[model samples]
Target: MKWSRAVHHVEELARRCDTPSPVPMLPVTGLWVFGDLLGEPRDLDWAHVAVIVDLPVDDVPWLDIPRGGQHWAQAVRLREPLSCLWRSAAGPVWNHRIVRPALVWDSTDGVRESTLSALRDGLGHSVRLDAPTPSALQTQLDAELAVSLRSLRRQHRSYDDQRWRPGKLTPHADSLWRATDGYLDLLDAVNAPQ
Candidate 1:
């Protein structure tokens, strides 16, 4: 989907927050728990949830902490930094409406299967992030995942260059549009140029 469509989906996702969901559906794939320590990967609890909908800009990372009743759908100008997940230090926190900010946004289905649980178990609590066998944790990623990851990386990079930027400022309807923006293809995304 284009920029406008992405925003529309974001709002739609927020309204559905009352509906229970395990893994993030379609466009919403990245979610995390807000814990005692802000930005600590170790503190992620399976209980906390919320997914990020990628925006057109990569340079500006935005975090929207819902007030009392506000939701992700209501979040304005969404961009989250690709780093440690954090809970808001101040105010009443909405459990699942917030997400970990990431620069390298990985929304592929394979990532959801592999790492989603690790986050649930609390990455820092169960797994030794700096342990020698850290590589062992990533053994699940296969060629298929690699292609999808590569494709998303390229799409993000393309946005980095204002020249190739594809998202429009206003709403543009395209039935063929997608949150992945035609980038999640297995072969084309892999072979496509950056």
Candidate 2:
């Protein structure tokens, strides 16, 4: 399924669940609703529904709102709405289709996951997001990570070259580069894969 279809299905699901209609944050970015608020899950009788965008592997954003919180997985299960789980490369990993009773993604037989109600509860709303092959997904992830690493390196260089210039400078730049360097090192480890 394309990103447009994914957004459509998720929007329909939200309305059918008696939740507020989704408001698109951007024309092609993603959609959000009252349920997506970070507070209590049952507020407004809403379940936090997150319709994450599935873009080309290299175009995926580094920061994804839906996947950010510490208790994100728990939130997904507790919220009980259908989730379009995006894997590493903005690939549609789950709930992109309604083929099984309990919507599962990433791998078959890996885990059991579902919503509290049946697919019929969606009020006839359904769709599928065409997902990429595993190798294709991995290539996308690698490309994004490589680009991110290079960008971070450039930032480090800018900070180093500017911080001690002939004029006065703020101390924040020191801490900024320190943090960036640490994160860059961590990404290096992740990119190495072994």
Candidate 3:
């Protein structure tokens, strides 16, 4: 998957925002979130996330995961409203909302593998992240998650470079490339259109 590029884009944007840094971005190599954090079986969709940011436990938000939506699979609620505009090779994108920090678990060994194995065995998987756990488990989870995000970023960069060639534009290609360029331009032109 072209996950590395997406991870890189998110990391770059996060850096530009000047917010408190969480754990470094890594690829979704082999990790999973286990415990009360995952409310239901359906929440597994978020299991494939390429980036997981580890936030202070105290600072983590206790917001409800929106019902049946894929848009903000990893979003958290915050007390104060905050927004940012980012441009990528794609086009202009806006993030308008408050965000909270939380512990991120890489699904590599935790949820990803166990869940799939359960499915294959004709058993269903269900667990919540909030349940109490030992510090050792938490440490392992965080470490794996960090590694995964980094790997994802590298993979994404490779995919983007391979799929999109620069300086060789047909009319159709020009329009598509323009969208990506426009996104970057908008980010650079924040508070002023270029």
Candidate 4:
């Protein structure tokens, strides 16, 4: 269940299932695998596979997806894309999960590289999967993730409570809530360091 193995596992499954990888389409700047694969190698076991897309992910026109390997793709989906503006919501988790392991990235226009660069600046450092993990970096990241999970759990509970209240909800409220629940479960599962 190491990083490479997990990626190979999913990829092998995709191959066996004859699933083609996706191509980032118009309005979708790029795609990159993120998560345990980007964490420390020894701590890379038991990962929750996820990717980031530039555009609003749901609006991404998938030219192709690993259809045969739809289960994981559908389950975790993504944590959503990061924005270049530091003032915007969704700050870094302090690692390569923010931007590396590029899959369909085309920085010819510099958009992809710029956003990632901006993110690194925001975090005050760069975290790269290709490089060796700095001492205790994994521990620091785990603590960061723990804080994120705790905060999300609180928000999710509040969301659930609001769902049952006497009020008219948006047409996609239930579906959006379910997606958030699934994401929370995925985060909860792979929050470990080893």
Candidate 5:
């Protein structure tokens, strides 16, 4: 499938799952695509796509995607029941090779660190998620994400920097940015006087 098609598929799947759409789907990056593709023992087609949603730390849900070949398209009960829902699709395959797709949301510090550690244990690498806070951290994360996005756009648009190795950009950049925006919206919703 074309990259665009794959992105659309993932986006639609995510929507169907009732997960809020925060950003346009982008290619999952960072790891050496080849190593990640080959390292997993399972059939690429059957590789499970995991989705992590961030709720208030105290209110976080505990759910597990069932083992065995269960596609996200199938209706499955969330282990940790939540009011919100979401769906996602597998990454694209190229020349019979599997690519992985991921979705993330802005979380609190406790949630972010715990989730990052879990992902790292499972995927064998450190993963960063944007944890947008209403406090000072939000400003810092927003600036960092913006810089990363700008650099990524440049690399995607030009090969001018054969030497300019782009830093690993997360799939959730846009979503995190949106979540930050949502935080601001929440402030307005609560009618906090400026």
Candidate 6:
């Protein structure tokens, strides 16, 4: 199904379900939607939809997700918030792939502006919901890697005397060390080659 139509279909379903229009999405920087565009009876053609969003920024890690990949489209529960980050860790991630569509995104905007019709219509410019190019994808990955490395470095540099007392490590220092190590591991995973 067309990206716009798929978006419309979801909006209508949300309305019929007595939910809000332009459903809330994960506040993080990625294009996300619920699993199966169609409601329960997955036999419907509209239920299987593929949407390619051209992001505003190329540095987002969300761009690493692959189509039909683990944690792509998630199943939204009645009381669940639209945001993906709010889900339980054991739940699915996202089903969409990270594409490098040539479209340039303003750092200020996010997937909501591109996916929600209300925001899309209100926007002064247009966005191309299309597949990504190899070059664009690589560039995005590079940017993401750089950001992760920088974050790791910043965390490393944040250490100070407060973190360590004269004879032993201070409580604050130990906490900082743990946090820095945890973040460093995460960044390392991101930097690892696919």
Worst window of 10 by summed lDDT in candidate 4:
80-89
Residues 1-194 of candidate 1 have per-residue lDDT tens digits of 23233323333333343243332322333343233212333322232223443322221112321122123333322232112222222211121223232111123432322233333333423322222232332321223334334545644454455444566622222211222443333245334453
**lDDT score for candidate 6 against the true structure:** 0.34
For model 5, which pairs clash? 13-87, 17-85, 17-86, 17-87, 18-85, 19-85, 19-86, 63-80
Error of 6 at 61 (Å): 7.7
lDDT of 5 by residue, 53-159 (tens): 22221111112111221242234332221122221122111111112322322222212333223333444223322333345434433433443344344434444
After superposition, which runs of candidate 1 have C-alpha atoms over 4 Å from their true positions?
Answer: 1-16, 20-72, 75-133, 140-149, 156-194
Worst 10 residues of 5 by lDDT: 89-98
Query: What's the TM for model 5?
Result: 0.21
Candidate 3 per-residue lDDT, tens place, 36-150, comes to 1223323222222122323221111111111111232233221111222111112111111111112122333333334433323323234212332344434433433343344
Model 6: lDDT of residue 18: 35
CA lDDT scores, all candidates in order = 0.30, 0.36, 0.28, 0.36, 0.30, 0.34
Off by over 4 Å in 5: 19-48, 52-72, 76-194
Error of 1 at 31 (Å): 5.5
State TM-scores per candidate: 0.23, 0.32, 0.20, 0.31, 0.21, 0.32
Give the root-mean-square deviation of each candidate in angstroms. 15.1, 12.5, 18.0, 12.2, 19.2, 12.6
Question: What tens-digit string does per-residue lDDT give for candidate 4 at 50-70?
Answer: 233333322211121221223
117 in model 6: Cα distance from truth in Å?
A: 7.9
18-126, model 6: which lDDT tens digit per residue?
A: 3221233322222234333312222223322223323232222232222222223343232222222111112122212322111121213423333345322423123
What TM-score number comes out for model 2? 0.32
